[model samples]
Target: MKPINRRSNAPVFWGLFGAGGMLAALFGPVLVFITGIAVPLVLILPADAMSWPRMQAFAQHWAGKGLLFVVVALFMWHAMHRILHSLHDLGVHAGTALKFACYGLALLVTMTAAWILVAVGF
Candidate 1:
């Protein structure tokens, strides 16, 4: 019998990571259902609906918010990797420029999320 080759796992890893993030997003609703608490639907609605008390509750529930952050950050990292590589493949080969642009965007997104999480006291 021939041995299985396992080199083509990058796509598999990315797919699983992305799916996990989606699941985490979905889990928020499940939590709301179980707890009978109306958490702000950040994933589905605009920031205007997010109130201070809701934010405080969200932050206080460490597990859910931490899971949310993990999902978002991982998804962002994976997306940035894929996007930068795709741009490079298209011959946009200013390596330093691409690197800085991608990293800067990622940082901005992360900071925004962090601020929201903190502002909500989560």
Candidate 2:
């Protein structure tokens, strides 16, 4: 008897969520520290560590663009998945429409970020 390949795509979504959660946990605080404290307080980075021109250049760079894309996309997937699962955990009625809406919003944000980054020019 031939067995059917009935695997689901849940792993992919879970992987994205894991990556995003890790990134958010690791980088979120570091980013905030650098931008909010270090730059302003002259601790590690310079005052203009996040200046406009520098930020524009970062967005224009290939590595920066990819980093931005991955972070944004993963974060969207993580947030959407969390929300969907949390609703279920909280005993809320999570229907297909809710799934579509949450995932759809994540996709929308990711696409918008990508478009804006591309429009920012390379």
Candidate 3:
């Protein structure tokens, strides 16, 4: 009989992790500093910059929906990857079950974000 071949899903998750890490490094802090803190305290960017109407309008756009979905999904996959690897150092010893749990949660969030984005309409 021919040898069996098994493919690992690690690369896909690693790719997502790298992309998300880059995104987070590049934009995450600025976003938090600007929206989470500045918008509330700085009195700089105009309070309405992140207002519901503006946000809703952005979400209603195709590009905005794509950005939102990619950001949410990639960040989630990135976080899950980190958590899975961290477990080893913490003595949790990542296993198949743990892998499933981590990746499964990422998949769930991705699906949910996609569903919501689609429902938001164009």
State which candidate has the highest TM-score.
3
- Candidate 1 positional error at 60, Å: 3.7
> Which pairs of residues collide in model 2?
none
Over 1-122, each residue of candidate 1 has an lDDT whose tens digit, in order, gives 87778675457536744664576567647656544434344455555445667656766687757866766665665567668778888987747787678756766776777777666653
List the candidate 3 regions with Cα displacement exceeding 4 Å.
Answer: 1-7
Order of the predicted models by lDDT, top scorer first:
3, 2, 1
For residues 1-91, what per-residue lDDT tens digits would candidate 3 score against the true structure? Answer: 9676877777988999999999888878987898789888856788788899998899999999988888898889999999999998999
Clashes of 1: 1
TM-score of 3: 0.88
Tens digit per residue, CA lDDT, model 2, 23-54 = 88977798788877898899978778889999
* Error in Å for residue 24 of model 1: 9.3
